[model samples]
Target: MNISTFGLGYVGGVTAACLAKGSHNVIGVDVKGEKVEMINQGKAPFYEKDLDNLISQAVEENRLKATKDVKEAVENSEISLICVGTPSNPDGSLNLDYVKKVCEDIGTALKYKNEFHVVVIRSTILPGSTENVLIPILEKASEKKSSGDFGVCVNPEFMREGQAIYDFFNPERIVIGETDKRSGDHVAQIYNDIHATVIRTDIKTAEMVKYVDNTFHAIKVTFANEIGSVCKRLGIDAHEIMNIFCMDKKLNLSPYYFKPGFAFGGSCLTKDLSALLSKAGELKLSCPLLEAIIPSNQEHIDKVVELIISQNKRRIGVFGLSFKSGTSDTRESPVILAINRLYEKGYAKLFEKGYEISVFDPNLDKSDMENLPSNIVPLLSPSLEEVVEKSEVLVIANNDKDFKRIPSLMREGQVLIDLVKVIEADEVKDGEYIGVCW
Candidate 1:
């Protein structure tokens, strides 16, 4: 495959060398004469582990070349990979000037080209950047429609600095966000021999994957450091603790609590986080991320309250009472907090003229009913159908299998505030349904 890489910086240089090593004809395009000259002379513009040798080998073998001419590069190559830098602005947003300029140059070069060219953005960008910014520029400049006249994709690079060559060849996953199937297949061909999982998705999801990966990595680092800080104050070995913690692959280092749903609320999570934050406070150590956990949870509860309040309905039905499904425990339950707020706002007044709140949970019996607020009417409904029939709005608070039947039982005007997304979006009308944290 003929490939052209824009911007001969770290990402581009490494990508070009690696692709050329894979036997793809790679042409590196750069504005700087020195960088272009260096690549042409079988020398790497920057130093990276095994990168210089790879570039020198590829150039010497006539599999790689460098030039300042975008037109020539575009004319010769079937695919162009944009590897330009998107540095941070003062306000913390991405500065996409380099990316935009390179796109324009590529688009202009595509004007005279008769063959279909695939433009893959290997640069790190925000979610909608590819479709909202790059595609429009390419279409206007080339006077061609994407997925028709040309192909476009957002194939984010996962290469780490200093270990660029290793990371390139041994990527954990290859993500291809394409405008069309042809574009995706073309991009996927570059990794045909590489042993990695190939994920083909929409352009926006592909763009956001890079940010999500990087931000999660940052969070992991800060989390470990905060734990270390608290451990050091108590003369405990944080490494030993983390080693054990990570050993629990079933829960700790797995996708156990990673789902996007309601705020975490159980006997352990809320209590443990509070204890950790308090210990950090006692040590006079500031752990912003750790400290913000509980407050962020409170905000999630508040958001549910606000969503319910926005409906302006008086009669409300809550499907579950426990902190989670299959349990009767209400200690630190987010649903309970939301219910409390609703009662305070006169949305839970049972016998009053303003509101009526009815709740039904298989786990909640007469004894459990005694602990709830006086305003919350615990319905002795033999079936969930009875509760759904009476309430104007239904809130699915837990991931119980019983609540999954609610979507099928939904009435015409009834609204569902779903914290656990058991109901499919396509199953209900758009305005009549709301996902709490989706």
Candidate 2:
């Protein structure tokens, strides 16, 4: 395969050299004469582990070269990889001037080219950037439509600094976002011999994957540092504590609580998070991430209240009042908080105007029912049919087996606000159903 890389900096330089080493003909394009000259002389422009040797080997073998002319590089290569830098602006937005300029140059070069070309963006960008920004620029300049006259794809690099060469050959996953099947297949051929899972998706999702990974990494680091600060104040070993925390693959280091659902409110999570934040406050340590947890949870509860009030229905029935499914504990339950807010604020005026609210939880005892407001009736009926008969809107708060039967029991006009997604999406009427975080 003939390949050309733009921006002969860290990412571009490493990519060009590695591709050439993989036996593909590579031509590196850059604005700086010094960088181009260095690549042509079999030398790396910047310091990277094993990069100098790889570049030297590729150049010596005549598999790699460098040029300042975009036309020369584009005409010679079938695939052009954009590896330009996206630096941060003073206001924290991405400076895409370099990216746009490179696109303009490539689009201009594609004007005279006759063969179908594939442009793969390996630069880190925000979601919608490839379609909303890059594709339009290319189409306007080249006077050609994407996936028809040419192909466009996004193949974001996951290489880290210092160990880029090793990471390149040993990637955990390969994502190729393409405008067409031909473009995806062409880009996938670049890693035919590499052993990694290949995921083909839309261009925007591929662009967002890089940001999601990096942002999660930043969050993990901050969370650990905050925990370390609290531990150090109490003369505890933070490293050992984290070591034990990471060992729990079932929950801590797994995808247990990572789903985008309702706010968590069990005895353990709410209590532990509060204790840690209070300890951090006592030590005068500012753990912003830890401090934000409770308030964020509160905001989610408030959102549920807003959703309920938006329907403009008076009669409301709630399913599962416990903190979670199959539990009787109501302490710090998000559903309870939402219900309280709905009664006190949402239906304050409506309650006196003959509006009704009822709750049905299989686990709810007469003692647990005492916490609810006087106007909101706690149903003592064993059958869920009775509760559904009296309500205009139903809220499913937990993933209980009993709640799964509510969809079949639902009348035509009744609205469902599901926080647990107990029923399949297709089983319910489209506009009548709403998920908390779907």
Candidate 3:
């Protein structure tokens, strides 16, 4: 494969060298003549371990070259990889001027090329930029349609500096966000020589994955540092504590708490987090991320409440009042808090007009009545069917297996707002189904 890599910097330089070593003829493009001259002389443009050697090897083998002309680079290559820098703006958003300029250059050059070239964006961009921004520029400049006259896919690079070459060959997984199957398959073909987990999905998901990966890394670092501050105050070994905490792969270091859904509200998470925040306060430690957990959780609940209220339904039904499924414990359950707010919101309308809030939880029995809030007692329905039949809006607050049938049972004009994704969006076509965070 003849590949043209735009931006002969960190990502682009390493990618050009590494892919060239993989037996692909890589043509590196850059506006800077220094980088082009350095690559052409069989020398690395920047300082990355093993990068110079790879570049020298590829160039010596006649598999790698560099050029300042985008037209000549794109005209000779079957694939063009955009690895330009998207540095931060003053307000912390991505400044895409470099990316846009490169796209315009490539689009102008692509107009003359007759081959069905694949344009792969390896730049770190936000979701919708590829389909909404770059593709439009390419289509307008080239005067051709995507996936027909050309192909485009987003293949975000995940290489750390100083370990770029090793990371490229030995990645944990490879993600290809494609507009069409042909484009995805063509992008996947480039990694045929490497053995790694390859997942092909839609363009938006692939674009968002890079941000999620980076932000989660930031979250992990912030969490560790905050806990380390608290540990240091008490003269405790933070590293040892973290090592032990990381040993529990089943729950701690695993995907147990990673699911996207409603906010967490249980006996353990809230109580423990609050205790830690209080301790941090007492120790005079400023842990912004730690302190924001409870408020953020409440914000999620408030968002759900606002969503429900915006429907303007007089009668609302809530399924599953427990903190989660498979439990009768209503202690610190987010749904109970939401139910209280809904009851208060609805009762105010009772003064002006008429409104009702009904709830049903399979785990709740006579013994659980004392565990619920005082305001929600009158709202509890005897049976799920009664709640479903009487309500104009149904809210699935937990992932109970019984609530899966609610979508099939929905009637016209009724709306189902799912907090835990108990039903698919397509399942409730008779009426309307909305997921809280989907």
Candidate 4:
């Protein structure tokens, strides 16, 4: 495969060197004469571990070359990868000037080329940046339809700064966001011999994946630092604690608590978080991430209330009264708070309005159900069908297997408010299924 890369910056420089090592003919294109001259001389302009050696070897083998001319680079390759920087503004938005300028140059070069060329963006960008910004620039510059005359894709790089060369050669995944299937296939073929998992998705999703990975990484770093601060104050080794925490493959340091669902309100999580923050407050320690846990939990509960209020239906059925499934405890349950808010909102009582509200918990003890509100009619029904049949809008506050089956029993116009992502609720077409934190 013949590859031409623009910018000759961090991403482009690394990509050109690595792709050349993979036996692809690579042309490094940039506007800076110094960067182009350095590449041609088999020297890395930027400082990176093992990058100099890779460039020297690729240049020695005649597999990599550098040029300041976009015309020459595009004429020499079938694919053009845009690796220009998308730096940040002071307000934290992306600075897309570099990306736009490179796209214009590529689009103009593309108009003169006869063969179909693929334009792959390896730059980190926000969602819709490709379609909303780059595609328009390319279309306007070339005066031709994007998919008709050429191919476009958002193949975001997942390389860390110092280890970019290694990360490029050994990536965890290869994500290709294409405007069309043909573009996807063309981009996918470039990594056909690589060991990474290939993901072909829509353009927007691919664009968003880079931001998600980066933001999550930032959160993890901050979380560890804040935890370390508290551990240091207590004369404990935070590293060892996190090491043990990371060892719990079943729960901690795994995908166990990473699901996008309802906020946590169990006896253990809620109580422990409050207790830790209280201790932190006594020490006068300002742990933003730690202090934010409870408030974020409250915000999640508030979202559930808003969902219920949005329906404008006063007759609401609240299922799973406990903080979680398989528990008789109702302490700090968001569902409990939601029900209280409904009471204050002037909704007629279930018995008074002659509209039945059923609460079913297969795992709950008989005593727990009997102790609930008098207006809350506790049903001994073992199945979810009874609950779905009784309510105009069903709210699933737990991931109980029985409750997960309610989507199948949904009647037309009935709303299923899901606090737990138990089923394929997003794809269910029977009725309006709303996830509290999807």
* Highest-scoring model, lDDT: 3
Per-residue lDDT of 150 in model 2: 89
The worst-scoring run of ten residues by lDDT in candidate 2 lies at: 372-381
In candidate 3, which residue pairs get closer than 3 Å at backbone N, Cα or C atoms, i.e. clash? none
lDDT of 2 by residue, 309-403 (tens): 98998888888877889888877788767877876684758655755667788987777667654544444445578778888898888888988
* lDDT at 212, model 2: 87
Best by TM-score: 3
Q: For model 1, which pairs clash?
A: none
Pairing residues by index, what is the TM-score of model 4? Answer: 0.92
lDDT of 3 at 81: 96
Model 4, span 210-310: residue lDDT tens = 98998989888999998898899999999998998888889876777777777777568878888888888877788898788888888877778778777
Candidate 4 residue 83 Cα shift, in angstroms, is 1.0
Over 4 Å off, model 1: 346-352, 370-382, 429-431
At residue 313, give the lDDT of candidate 1: 83
- RMSD (CA, Å), candidate 3 to true, equals 1.5
In candidate 2, position 376 carries an lDDT of 43
Could you tell me the lDDT of residue 429 within candidate 4?
74
Against the reference, the lDDT scores of all candidates come to: 0.89, 0.89, 0.90, 0.83
